[model samples]
Target: MTEHTSIRIRVTGHVQGVGFRAWTQARAEELGLWGWVRNVADGSVEAWVSGPAGAVADLVEALGHGPAAARVAAVETGPADAASDAAGAGFRILR
Candidate 1:
């Protein structure tokens, strides 16, 4: 049976202020994933995702290329706590 999985992705390189977070929000919604994307002061983008394993994998692959303006260097994904309340239904952009 398919199971729900939570993923935390830290994207390195030029991924801030270039609509990367917004793009991720849209992408996650398109794949019916629940998550939140945010920009960090360290010039990276972080996201907490929860959904079907396949969809989460797709999201991570997309994040590596991000928006046209974003120069994504790397993407790291891992298991997240099941009880973590990091995001609500539908993808949102965090401050």
Candidate 2:
């Protein structure tokens, strides 16, 4: 079986108010990853994604070049604790 991995990422730049969360959700879902994306107070986007390591990595790469409206400056990624529940089964945009 393919090993799954989780990652927490913080994307900075023109990420908020530019459909970053929704765009991220769509991208994650397309990759069959489960996790959530939200706007941070500091004008950044944060997300926790878990799935096949390759898929998660792909998502991270996409975050760097978000929707055309977004001007992603940086994407920081780190390991995240895996959840037992079906946390990665669906992607969501959190407020």
Candidate 3:
């Protein structure tokens, strides 16, 4: 079986008010991942993603260039706790 991994990603630059969270949720779900994406007070997008290692890596890569409206400048990732809980079975957009 494939090993599961978890990561916390922070995407900077032109990520707010441009459907970044929604886009992230869709992408994560499409990759069969479990996580939550939210807007940060610092004008960046934050997400806690957990799933198959490959899928999680794919999601992180995609975050580098979000929705068409987004102009992503940087994407920072770090290890996340495995017990982090998502809102539902699939990916979710957190307020």
Ranking by TM-score: 3, 2, 1
Q: After superposition, how far is residue 77 of candidate 1 from its true place, in Å?
A: 1.5
Where is model 3 poorest over a 10-residue stretch in terms of lDDT? Answer: 81-90
Full candidate order by lDDT, most accurate first: 3, 2, 1
lDDT of 1 by residue, 1-95 (tens): 87778978899998887888888999999998997888888888888899888999999999989999999888987777667555447888989
Candidate 1 segments whose C-alpha is farther than 4 A from its true place = 86-88
lDDT of 2 by residue, 3-31 (tens): 88888899999989888898999999999
Whole-model lDDT per candidate: 0.86, 0.88, 0.90
TM-score of each: 0.90, 0.92, 0.93
Q: How many residue pairs clash in each candidate?
A: 0, 1, 0
Q: List the residue pairs that clash in candidate 3.
A: none
Better of 2 and 3 by lDDT: 3
Evaluated against the true structure, the overall lDDT of model 1 is 0.86
Model 2 residue 2 lDDT score: 87
Highest TM-score among the candidates is held by which one?
3
